[model samples]
Target chain A: MANGTLVLIPTPLSGQPLAFSHPPEVLSRIHKITDFAVEKLQQAVHFLVKTGHPVPEYKMGFHPLDKHVTGEQLQDILAVLQQGRDVGVLSEAGCPGIADPGARLVWLCHSRNIPVEALVGPSAITLSVMYSGLNGQQFAFNGYLPVDSHRREQTLKTFEGRSANDEQTQIFIEAPFRNRELLGAMLELLQPETRLCVCWNLMADDQWVVTREVQDWASASLPENFENKPAMFLFLATPRQKAVSGKKSARSKSTGRGSRTTGTKKGLHRKRYNPD
Target chain B: MANGTLVLIPTPLSGQPLAFSHPPEVLSRIHKITDFAVEKLQQAVHFLVKTGHPVPEYKMGFHPLDKHVTGEQLQDILAVLQQGRDVGVLSEAGCPGIADPGARLVWLCHSRNIPVEALVGPSAITLSVMYSGLNGQQFAFNGYLPVDSHRREQTLKTFEGRSANDEQTQIFIEAPFRNRELLGAMLELLQPETRLCVCWNLMADDQWVVTREVQDWASASLPENFENKPAMFLFLATPRQKAVSGKKSARSKSTGRGSRTTGTKKGLHRKRYNPD
Candidate 1:
C-alpha cells in the first residue's frame, strides 16, 4: 500500500467563528482524517464538533503534540503513515507552523520522507497586510517581540528600519494583554510618516481594519471595545510613489499587472498610497 | 443609507478547482455581489458561471479594471460602494494585490475611508513555508526575482545571505515559462548548504512539495511533470539543530518552549546545513 500522507490543517484565528474562516471543503477534509495531532486535545475536539463534524461517525482520534511531545514520539506517529494510515497535524489556531507549534512535526515528516500537504484557510497575518494597502510585494512576519520595554523598542526600530531600507512591510502580533504597550512603543518608535495598519479581532463580527500615518494617529484612539482583543499590526515606511505627478498615465507598479494606474490630477489631492 | 463594504475576494490558485479553495459562504458572497471589478472580465464571468452561478439570474454586471483602468476609474468603482452597493474585486488567479492586480482598488477603498475586508483562501507562499519546517517566526515573500540570469543569480545570493544572517525564510515565485531557468539559477548560485523547497501546481491534484539541501538537490531531479507549472519556492539557511543527537531518547528543537538547547557535546555528527 502507498504510504499515507501527513496533512497540515488550518484552524480559525482566535475568537473567530470556525466556519467563517473555512469552507465546506476544508471541513470535509477534517471529516476524513481519522487521526490528528494537535496542541490542545480538547480544543481540537471542540473545533471538529463545532465545524459540524460527527466525531464518532468519522471515528476520529486525537494524539497530543503540544510542547510536551518528544521527537521520539513524533517518529512513532510517523509510523502511522508508514503503516499506510493517514494522520493530520493541526495548529491550535490559524495555519499550522507559521507562528504555531506544528512546524516540528512537518519538518519531521520531511526527514522521514512522508508526503505532506497544507489545506487552504484563513491566515490573519496575510489578510492584515493585504487590507493595509502597504507594500505587500516584500514583507516579513515578525512574531511576538521582546517583553522588556527597551528590547521591544529596539525590535520596532529594526522593523521600521527594514520598512524604510528595503521597502519590506513588517507584520507583528502582540499578546492581547500587552496590546496597549506595543501600540505605545510603535507610536514612540515609528516616524511620523510611517503608516500603521491595525486589524482588531479579525474574522469576528466586530472586526475593525484601519490604516493611517503615525502623524494621523496622534489625536486618534482605538475604540474602548477593541482593547485587549487579539490584533495584527503592520508598519510600512516605504517612500510614497510620485505617481500622483500625472506624468505617467498608464504606469504599472510591481504587482499591478494589467491595471493601468493613470492617476487623474484630482487623485493627488487625496491621500493615495502607491507601493512599488 | 449605510455604504456597502468592498469585499476583496480570493480566487483559487491557477489550476486549482474553485471548490477546493473556497467554501459555500464565499460562493454565497459571490452570488450576492451584483457588481464586480476584476483583472480579467471574461475570466471572472467564466469563474462564476463554472461555480454554478446563474450569471444572468444573479443580474451581475462586470466593470473592467484591467491594466488599462485608470486610477480615476478605480475611484469610480469605489463610488459603487458609496452608492450603497457592494462590489467584489476579483483577481485573475490567487489573492488580488498580493501577487496580483486587485490591490489598487483595496488601497483606493482605504484612502476614501471605505471599509475593506479580505476573504480567506489558499496562499501558495504561506503554505510553502508551513510545509518547509523552516523558522516560521520570520519570513519574507519576495514576489518575483530578476529575470536576467546574472541579475537573478545576484538576487538569489542576497536572499540566501538574509536566510543565513537572520534565519528568515525566503520565498519567491517564478513565471511558469521561466521555471526551469530559475531552478537552474538556484542550483548554480546557491551554496551547498542552502535549503530549497519547491511546490509545483499548488492546490491542484498533481501538486508536489519537497525540500532538500542544495547538495542533496544535486543528486535529485524534478519530476518531468513539474516543468511548466507555476511553483512556489522557499530557501532557509538557519543553523541546523543537533537535536538529532542520539544521547536523548526524544528531544525537540525550538518550539518546545521550556526546553533548553545546551549544545550538548554529543551532537556534532548530523549533516548540518548552516546557510552562512
Candidate 2:
C-alpha cells in the first residue's frame, strides 16, 4: 500500500498563538491531522490545543521525533502511515526540517516514496534576511557558525570572502547565551565598513531589528537584557551599502561625533556608536 | 518625529486566494494600511479585495515598485512615513523584500533609521530547502542562477564544491521557462551521485516536490506542465545520502534497474526514477 502523506507543520517562533502567524487554511489542515512527529511532546500538545486541533486525552497522541529518532522508530512511524494515517512533523521552533530533526522523517518519506507537503509559515531565517536590507536577490544562511574561537574566526572570514565575491548577504545565528561573544567577534573580525544587521526576539511585541556598519558599532553597548536571547546576524559587502556607509560618515562628520543615538530605554537596545 | 514602520507584506505564491495563505492578523494589518509599495498595482488591488482588505476605489492607492523604483521615488514614499502613515510593501509573490523590489525601500528604511516590521509568512526558498531532505542546517539560497551558459555551469560547480566542503546544501532558482534547461545542466554537469531536489508550484493544490540523486534522475523526464512555471532546486554533497545511493544500487541489482516508481495521478505527483 502507498504510504500516507507526511505534512511538515511550522510552529510559532515565539509565544504568539497559531492564528497570529498561520493562515486559516493551514490551521484547518492541522485540525484533521491525528498522528504527529514532534521534537517536544509537551510543547506540541500545548500548541495543538491552543490552535484548536483535536487531540486525544491519552499521552500517546504525539510521537517524539527528536535528534535521537532511530531508524527502527522511523520504520515504526512509517508502519502507521502504511495503514493510511497522515502524520505531521513539528519542530521546536520555526519551520520543521530546517535546522531541525524533522528532516530525518522527510528524508525517510522520500526514500519510501511517501507523499509529503510543506505548509507555509514563519521562518526566522527568511524574515531576518528580509529585514536585513541586504542583498535579497542572493544570500546564504549558515545556520550556526562554529563555537570554537579559531574555527569561528575562519568561518567568519570565509563568509566575508563569499559575500565580497558575489554581493550576497551572509546570515548566521548564535546560541542565546553566546550572542554577546559572537557580537564581539564579528566586530573584531569583519571588515570595518561591512553593513551588519542584528535582530532580537522576532514575532513578539518587543521585537527589534537594527542594521549598521561594523565600524560604527565598535563602541556600541548591547541592551542589558540581550545577554541571553535568540538573535540573527547579517553582513553585506555590496557596493551600494558601502556607498551608504560613505554617505553616513560624511553626515556624521557634519553632525559632530557621538551624535548618532540608537539605544532606547526599553529592554531591547543598542547604544550610540562612539568609537574613540 | 519618529517614522511609521515599513511593513513587509507577503503575497500568495500561486493561484490560491490571499486568505488561504495569510493569517487573519496579517490581513488586518493590510486592511488598516493605506500606503503601499507593490510590484503590480492591479494584482495588489485584486489580492487586497479577495482578502477583504479595504482599498480606496481610486487608482492611486497602489504605488508602482519594480526593479526600476528610483531613489527619488523611494524618498517620495518615505515622505508618507514622515506623515505618520505606515507603508505596506507587497511583492508579486511570496514575501516582500526577498527577490523583489521591496528591498530597495527596506534598504532605504535601514539607511534612514526608520522602524521596520517583517511579518511572518510563506517563503518559497525555505519551503524548498525543507523538502529537499538535504543538509538543512547549513544552506545557501543563490537566487537566480546566471543566464549565460558558461557562467551557469561555473556557478553550479562552485555550489557543488561548497556543498562537498562543508556539507552545506546549495539552492538556486531559475526562470520557469528555463527549468528544463537548468535541470538538464544540473544532471549533466553535477556529479552522478549528488542529491538533487526540485520543487515546483509550492502551496497550491497542484504543488509538487521531489528529491532524488542526480544519477537516478539522468534518464527521467520532467512533467509536461512543468514548462515555464516557477520552481526551486537544491542539492547537497554529503556522506549519508551517498550511503543511501550505494544501498539503492545494491537493491537495484536484485530487483531490476527500472523498478523505482514514485508517482500517482494525484493532487501532487513525484515521478519515477528509471535508470535504464
Highest-DockQ candidate = 1
Query: TM-scores, in order shown?
Result: 0.84, 0.84
Positional deviation of residue A202's Cα in model 1 after best superposition, in angstroms: 0.6
Per-residue accuracy of model 2 over B133-213 as CA lDDT, tens digit each: 776666776655555666667767867876766566787766666678889899899988888999887877777887888
lDDT of 1 by residue, B1-276 (tens): 777788878777655566668866778777777888887777788777766774673477567765456767777787788998888887666666565556567666776778787888767676777778766666787666655555566667767876666556788776666667778888888888777887787777777777887778876667685556777778887553422112112211213222211101111111232211
* Model 1 Cα shift for residue A275 (angstroms): 6.1
lDDT of 1 by residue, A139-176 (tens): 78755556566656666776677666656678877666
Chain B TM-score for all candidates, comma-separated: 0.81, 0.82
Q: Which stretches of candidate 2 lie over 4 Å from their true place?
A: A57-60, A218-221, A239-276, B219-221, B239-276
Report per-candidate DockQ: 0.24, 0.20
Which docking band does candidate 1 fall into?
acceptable
